[model samples]
Target chain A: MSSQSFNRLTPYLFMAPAAIIMAIALFYPLLYMVFGSFRSWDPSQSLSETEFVGLANYIKLLGDEAFRESVSVTLTFAGTVVVAEMFIGVGLALMLDRNIRGMSLLRTLFILPMMIAPVVVGLVWRFMYHPTDGIFNRWLTQLGLPRVDWLGDHALMSVIIADIWQWTPFIFILSLAALQSLPRSALEAARIDGATGWQQIIHIKLPLMAPVLIVTCLLRLIDAFKVLEVILVMTEGGPGLSTEILALRISRTAQEFRELGEAAAMSNYLLLLLMVLTLGMFTFTRWQEARAQQLNKVKQEEG
Target chain B: MPKIRLDGLVKRYGAVEVLHNIDLTMEENEFTVLVGPSGCGKSTTLRMLAGLDIVSEGEIYMDDRPISRLEPKDRDLAMVFQDYALYPHMNVARNMSFALRLQKRPKEEIDLKVREVAKILGLTEYLNRKPGELSGGQRQRVAMGRALTRDAGTFLFDEPLSNLDAKLRGQMRAELALMRQRVQKNMVYVTHDQVEAMTLADRIVVMHGGYIQQQGTPEELFKRPVNKFVAGFLGSPPMNFMDVTLEETGEKFFARGDGFRIALPGRLADRARRVGQSELTMGIRPSDLNFDAAAPDSEAMDLRVSISEYIGAQSVLICKCGEATVTVEVKSETPIALGETLRFAVRPEGIQLFDKKTEDAL
Candidate 1:
């Protein structure tokens, strides 16, 4: 090969090892799961012994009531945690944006929940929600309020609260960063333009932070959908599928029911949902970049 | 328009004081320009006037009302920032009408006011375009239009034209001057560019090291600068300073220095004598020095031309006068060449003297 061609091939040669490893470690299983979804495969059976049952597993999942309930539960958990976290996170960020003596320390504390191990967070929250011995119920009893069932009838609510506790700080730090990076002069201009503190936040602060906030929200939403460990440790999808999110349901379908093909199909459904959300975020950022580039082109042309 | 006053104003950030006691009063509808170098407390004073910065030790009064404690909105003022701090998300029309809209004014009134200001600024065609889409000059106009739409009693401009390119700055400056004529408001502008201060201000306040050096009309400050700093700062190709001994020979007073000696005019000599200082600094503007080889020795200085900077119509000749470098402005057509000694006649009326010890005007 010529020198230029050799130089071009050098990068590919360096990338070949990682590419092969990815194909073996990532794509092999993905393709295997997709292939197995079309067959009546069991964990004990070899791939060659499985019988081809094209569309059967997908059709079964489509008609399954438990599957539909799990999908709805997943949606509710992701939606509730994301929306609640966004509001509370953005509110806290705005309140803490100013300078105080211990503001940096306070911000570090605010992000501590996200830094902790997810399983540990779940275990701690589980203990906190322990029906009678939990701190929450103990405080309620002391306050003359009725001791409520935290992980029983309100299992979904309890798991959601736990997830929110672990994830709200993720949104908080991102929102705080966005708030701090906003153009200071614009806020000062708003002040001189007679905008009240609330007005400045509404007109200047929030609008400027929209792009970062949108990306942060979408990222959190994607993560929330794939959340398994926290809920698994906290409620274990307890009280008859009340908090059986799709991830937990998929694991149960493969492990407890031993329906490997059905579990693969369920995983594909989750993957499809996450793929759409990822595409949405990708398009949003691309659109913003394109608009900015076009604006620069226009500015240059005028100049 | 109400008269504005900053009485004994001071600013401190923790233990470090950036602005000392500043007292200034602007008459109704007067254009006041605070001209200074960087970090000279000019912008700080303007921010204080706009209530953007707190008055650390003094009060700002408008028409006898102490407005230091009130919010910027209650102070009834509009400000144009250096970066043309137009809302990036808002279009020209929205940016211009934001103040009025915040006040919840009638929609028709806001629209009418925005349209009027846009037409004045020549931003009517770009009203729907966001700041990002517009060029820097257009963004500057949008900032100006934002302030104009407020119709506030006072307008504070903090280096509004500094962000634009050279040509755009000149064009915007002319537009600003024209706008000033059309709009009768208390306008306080801050700039480090002396040309802008000279052209736009009814009263120019020259500041240095957190202190006001001098404040007067543009011509007054130019013709009679109170000290060495103001004299050197206000003019282009700035005033040349030469150390000279004030020698009295018989009836006339002469300023004798190395490589040149010039007779002092009667008025300047009397002032120098009254100050009772023999060692003095003489100031002569480049514009006051004419290229005249035939001029008498007592009225002319022999300057050795070192370099010539051609800047259209006129060229500035950098010359050597003893150990000091002096700049002389002359017509480009003038026959001058490097390495040649030339005599430049000093205008008698243009001579200024400062006490060498105090650096204050004599």
Candidate 2:
């Protein structure tokens, strides 16, 4: 090869190793699942012995009532947890964005929950929600209130509370970062313009932080859709699939029911939902960039 | 309009105090410019007056009412920041009318006020454009328009034109002067540029090292500075200082230095005699030095011209006298040659003498 051609091929040569590793580690399993999703496969038989079912697994799962119930449960959990976390997280950020003694220590302590392992968080919460020995029920009994079922009848609510407890700090730290990076002089200008404290937040702080908050919300929504280990360890999707999200359902389909093809189909459905959310995030950032470019064009024309 | 007075105002951050016992009074409808170098606490003084910062030891009074404890909104003022801190999300009209909207004013009234200010600022055509779409000069106009629409009793500008380019800063400075004439409100502006302070101030306050060096009319501060820092800070080319000793020659006083001796005028000589200091520092402005060859030796200094900076109608010649460098400003038509000795006569009345140790004017 000529020197020019070798120079052109140098970057690709350097990238070849990582590319091959990604193909084997990531794409290989993805392609295997897509291939098995179209077959009637079983764990007992090798892949060569399975028969090509041609949409049979997908059609059956679509008609299954248990699968539909789990989809609704997943949607409800994602929606409630994201909305509740956004409000509580941003509220905490705004409240703690001032200068006081011990504020740095308090802020460090606020994000500790997000650093804990998900399974450990689940177990800790599971113990906390015990009916008789739990601190919540014990306090309720002491306050003359009835001891209520936590993981039994209200299993979905209990798991949602646990998920929010572990994830709200993620939103809190991000929102605080967005808050601290805002132009400080703008706030001082607002104060001189006669904006009260609440008025400053409603008009100045929130509007200026809109872009960061929107991207953070979309990212958290995508992550919330795939939550599994916390709920699995806390309630194990018990009491008739009340808290059984799609990830847990897919695992049960493959492991307990011995239906590998149906499990792959279920996993494909979850991937589709997450893909849409990721595309939404990508489009939002692209729109922001386009608007900025248009603004620069206007400025250049004026100049 | 009400007169504003800062009575012994002090500011401290932790154990470090940034402003020391500042006492100043601004009359009704006066334009006061606090001019200083960076970190001289001019901005801190303005922020304290605007109620953006707390007064550590003293109080602020407006028309005999103590207002140091009041919030910025209750103080009834507006400020223009250095970076033109307009709301990025709001367009020109909305940004200007934000204060009125916060007060829940009528829609028509807010619209009328915003349109009036926009027309004054020549921003009518771009009223719907956001701050991001505008250029630097346009953003500066929007910031000014935002303050104008509030119709507040006092206006504070904290280096509002410093962010613009040199040409744009001059244009905005002239516009600010025009606006000052049209509006009769009390205005307090802070800047580090001496030219802005000289041209736009009804009263100029010079500060250095967290202390007020001098405060007076522009001409008074220029011609009669109380100290050495004020003398050097208030001019474009800056006043030149030469170490000189006061010599007595039969009822006539002469400032004798290394290479030149200048006769003092009667008024200055009397002031120098009253101070009775032997070792003194002599000051002369660049504009006061005239290129004269036939002038007497005692009245002129022989300087070798080194570099000539031609700036349009006038030229500033950098020359060497003995070991000290002196700058002389003359007409561009003056015939001058480089590396040649020339005589530049000093104006007797322009001579200022300061005590060498205290740096205070005699």
The candidate scoring highest on DockQ is 1
Q: How many backbone clashes does candidate 2 have?
A: 0
Candidate 2: regions farther than 4 A off? A301-303
Per-residue alpha-carbon lDDT of candidate 1 for residues A195-251, written as tens digits (9 for 90 to 100) = 999999999999999999999999999999999998899888988889999999999
Q: Specify the CAPRI tier of model 1.
A: high
Off by over 4 Å in 1: none
- Model 2, A28-119: lDDT tens per residue? 99999999998888999887899999899989999999999999999999999999999999999999999989999999998998999999
Fnat of all models, as shown: 0.92, 0.87
Q: DockQ for all models, in order?
A: 0.81, 0.81
